[model samples]
Each structure stands twice: as structure tokens, then as C-alpha cells.
Target: MHNATVIALRTVATILILATFVPLLPFEAWYIRIFDFPRSQIFVLAAFTLLIFLVLRWWRYGIDKILIPGLVASLVFEAVNIYPYTFLSPVQVQQAPADAPADGQLSILVSNVYQHNVEHQLLIDLIQEHSPDILLTLETDSIWQKGLRPATDSFPERVAIPLSNTYGMHLYSKLPLRQTRTRYLLEEEVPSIKTYVQLRNGVWVELHAVHPKPPVPTEDDDSKTRDAEIVLVGKEVKGSDYPVIVAGDFNDVAWSHTTTLFQKVSGLLDPRIGRGFYNTFNAKYKLLRWPLDHVFHSDHFKLVKMERLPHINSDHFPILAILSFAPENKYEQEEPQPDEDTAEEAAETIEEGKEEAQEEDD
Candidate 1:
């Protein structure tokens, strides 16, 4: 009985340690990249294992000395990735002052209404209640488009792409949207919206609404296409003359390597930094959730208010962000800039995505 217990503890410790380092591999395979989602869960399990080890006084077993170090290292790695999202870290995007001008403010709501969940009235009611200046919805089909008409009617300007493929997106804005274009950046079926939104203050801000494909067995074999699309958008936003805001269900975690790289490449700031995770996905499963939906903006904007909204009969919850466009104070917030190596890596990833996409099409 004693021998069996020791072996069980050793096996569990080994699995946890390996899981922590699996994502470090330079691979895009779904099996490996999927490990990127549950860093917090892994941390908890590692901590629990370490406690059990100490409680059992397993150090007397000698082998535990080796396993203990591995567990500690895993905990440290996960902590480093999760720390920036906690309040203990410095905020990457500054908050707007209490006296921030109302005219310079813009509120956005982003939701991925699971396509088959037809409780449209719940979302409609939520929309009517919040009344954001801009609304972006993913997984909208023809039925969803019609179902959301009551709420969307209030938004005078819009871009609607209704498809059954679950990648359909719709962007409705109370503020005027100019030069709106629906782009199939990498995959033909997947669409992204790019446009300039004229804020109430008459300042033009570039907005990109995207719902990139996820790395899952049912979706794609790997994350190359998704990473490429994000990087492509990042590269484009890097040179934008106007202040930029990119928001949607990223299908990637806020703390993942791809997201970090995107920030560096685009010079965008995430308001969640030093705030909270604001986990939006897996609304159905509290224990298994992460911040897959994101809203990233240029330093020109300061966060006024950001919150995760109530679930509206979907697998994912909505996120609302009220930001004040304060370009004058942009210099106060440090922007993430990509070094030469990062730029080269981003370029290579984009090229690879394009090649893979072309090959798939062929």
C-alpha cells in the first residue's frame, strides 16, 4: 500500500510538470497550443500537489527531492505568465480622469453569441439596457441577424456578415462608421471587419472586429492560421495614422505568447493588464474559463470602465469597455514596441499562414 501511494504521487507530479512545459515547444499543433488555455488550472494543481508532498513528508523518500524542484519551477512559470493580469502588476493602459470629457468617450460591447443558442431576446434586452456606442457580435447566422434586428435598429451604421459557418460577424455602431470593409484575411470563410469610427468628439478611430478560428480538432489542425491572422492585423494597426481599437472573441487567451506578440507588434495596450482576467469564455463552466474575448487599443485611449457583462444564454459572456480618447495623454502610457527579432518572427508567421492558407485552397 505504501509503495502504490508513492508511485501514484510521483506519476501525478510528473504529468503536472510536463504539462507546464509542453506549451513552450515551438509548435502550432492543436494538442500543444491547447495547453496554453489552462495555466491557472495547472498552477492550482501544482500547488495542491506540492502541499500533498509536504503533508506526506515525502522528502524522506529521496525521489521527491527531484520532483519537488520540478513542481516549484512549474509554479513559477505559470505565475510569471499570470502575474501581469493581476492587480499587483502595473496597468499597461492608464485610466481616464474623473473629469474626462464625455464627448471623447466611447463605449463598446463585444459578445460571441453561440450560434445555436436561439435566446436572442436575452441578448437584445442586454443590448437595450447597456446601449454601447459600438456592438460587435460573433457566430451570427441569418437567423441571428434577423433576431437581433430590434436591438441593431438603434445603431444607424453597421457591417453585417451572416453565415452558417459560425465565423459570421456583425458590427453595429451608434457612431458613424466610415470606409467599412469586410475582409477575409486568411481563410475565405472567416471574415473580419475593418473601419474607422467617428467618435462623438469627431475624432476618427480605427476599429478591427475579429473572431479568429480556434485551435481545436473540430476547427483547425493547428493555430498557424489564427496566429497569422492576428499578426497580420497587428502589423496593419502598427502603421495606422489614427488611434486603433481591436476587439472580439480572440479565441486565444489574454496571456498567451501570441497575444503578447500581437501587443508588441501592434503597439496596443490591454486594459486588463494590472486589472483582472475578466474571463469571458466557458461561461457555462466556472472552473474552466479564461479571457478569450479581448479588447485591445492604442495608448491614445484611457480606460474609463471595463466589465464582464451577464451571460446571455451563450457559452461566452459579453464584455463592455468604456474608453476616453485622450491622445494628448498618450505619451503617459508606455506602448509595446516590437524589436527586430519580434518583427522578423511576426513576418515569418504571417508568411507561413498565408502559405498554409494558399495550399489549403489549392
Candidate 2:
């Protein structure tokens, strides 16, 4: 190969490899954390770069020292980070018990209906069509709440906290709700809903719906608040004796460090473990999508069904999941357990969030 061509290839490969290191830094800035959303894309790019380097390289110079090792490391890191979300990985949550009666099943639909989105009827129609037992909507405001009221009238039990700041939440359930409250976990402007709902079989299940602010230049400068809110929920649900379900657009990917910590701390299992990345955000861009919407459950519930619904004029695609409460299947699934380091990190993150909130209050 020509000397100029060799130099160009080495430079390109080096740049790609270096880009993968952004997520490894122990920083939560939006510029760095955004790298965590595209591990799959990064893996594809790194693998392609490695293949090109292998086929076009010569042993003429010491280029091998810099380019080859870097490319290899990048490929390995990306693959390891994204491997769990692939089909080759083992399922984290087991299927619902085959013999469990239909009465034990709970169907839920969660959507982050972008506030400025004008197509309110699309969401209303979807709700009527799916008729899920519980409907949780985020990014809702007064206009959205009023528009959806008629369609959701059948959902007699409701909790609505409408705001125009794009942090609104509304939860409607057909089942009877016991002790439902809208709490501001970290930021008072951001609301989270917690309630105990009765299933058809007269069994009670605790449910939490949350939409933490995304770590972006426009939304939040860092991920501390988002991480803290998620960690707090995880810690709260960890010791719960009742079956628990936490669902919504978390504004973070399933494989992120904070999310993994959340699962381990809460003893919750993501239904997308062995399943494909049901990429729900950035509905307009196919390649830029990730699984921002999630449905996690405790061991007492098994997955009856899970799916990513079609896009509704919003930037996010809705998610629907049906879970069955069968104690027998609890042993079939494995729950995540955080090691000493992760536990300590979570506690520190929560404390940091508390201090920041206090400063803002003062």
C-alpha cells in the first residue's frame, strides 16, 4: 500500500477507537454520557474499521503498534457493552407460567407523549385499540390531560399531575387503586407516581411510573438528578414484599451503568435482556434510536408479552407489556445483585443528588 494511504487509514482507525473511550470516563456530562446511548452503533463502526485495517495494512512501518491494538480494544469494548441486549444472551426474565390463569395477568401501556405534539387523537385511538388495564402517560400537560380525559374516562382510578415543562405524568387504571400518590423524588418539578393496584384475581401489585430528565444540553447538564431518581426508586423497591412494576420512558438506555445499578439495587429484571433493543426514542431516526422506554418487574411476575408499539406523532414510541403474577415462576428468573462497589456508588450518587437539591432550595 502507498505511504499516504497507510497514514490516512491509521488516522481514521485511531480516531474511531479513541471515540469509544468517552463513555468509560467517570463523568456524567451530557457530552460524555451521550456515548452510552449508542454502544451498538459504536460496535458496528469499530468492527467495520477493524476489518478494513486488517485487509489493507502492510508490515512496512511501526503503524501496527498504534492502530491495530487500539482498533482491537475498541471492538472488544463495544461488543462486551452491547452483548447482553443481543439475542445470543440469556433471558433475564422468564416467561409467564404456562398454567397461570388469565386472571393473574396485568396489561400495561406506557407512552411519553411529547407535550408539543398536536396529534392527541393518535394516542387516544391507540389507547382504545389496545385497552390495556393500565395506561401511563408522561410529558403530558393541561392540554394533553384535557384532550385525553374523554378517552380515559373508563379508567376510573386516575392520578394526574399535568405541567407544561415536559415533565408531566398521568396514570389511569381500570383496576381499583389503593393509596396512590404523586411524589417528587429529586426535582420537585419532576413527578413520579406510586400506587398499589388490585388485579382481577383480587391480588395487589405495587406500580411506579417515572420519567426522569434526560442528560442533555437542553434538559440537564449532568445525569446526577436522573441517576439519583432511578437509584432512589431501586432502593425503595428492593425490600418490597409486594409484586412491583416500574415502567416509563426513563431517559436512559437499558445497558447504561446507572440502569444496571438500578436493576441490581431494586432486584428488578428488564424484559429486554435477551430480547432485541426495542429502541423507543428518536422515532424519526432509525439509526439513532435506543431503548429509552422500559418495563421492569420483581420476581413475583413473569413476562406474558412485551412489545414496542408504532410511533404516534411523538419522538418516542409507546411500549406495552403484559405480566403474570405467578409465584411458581419466580424461581425461573434470575434477579441482578449489585456488588460492593456498585452499592457504594449508588449511595454516593443519591447523597450527591440530595446535596444538590438542598443547595437549590437554599
Indicate which candidate wins on TM-score: 1
Off by over 4 Å in 1: none
Compared with the true structure, all predictions reach lDDT values of: 0.94, 0.88
Residues 110-229, model 2: lDDT tens digits: 999999998999999989998999999999999999999768998999898999999999999999999898899888899999999999999899999999989998988888888999
Each candidate: RMSD: 1.1, 1.9
Whole-model lDDT, candidate 2? Answer: 0.88
TM-scores vs. true structure, each candidate? 0.98, 0.95
Error of 2 at 242 (Å): 0.7
Provide the lowest-lDDT 10-residue window in model 1: 54-63
Error of 1 at 348 (Å): 1.1
> Model 1: per-residue lDDT, tens digit, 1-362?
39898799899999999999999999999999999999898999999999999888876777788899999999999999999989999999998999999999999999999999999999999899999999999999999999999999999998999999999899999999889999999999999999999988899999999998999999989999999999999999999999999999889999898999999999999999999999998999999999999999999999999999998989999999999999888999999877779988999989988988898899
Worst 10-residue lDDT window for candidate 2 reads 56-65
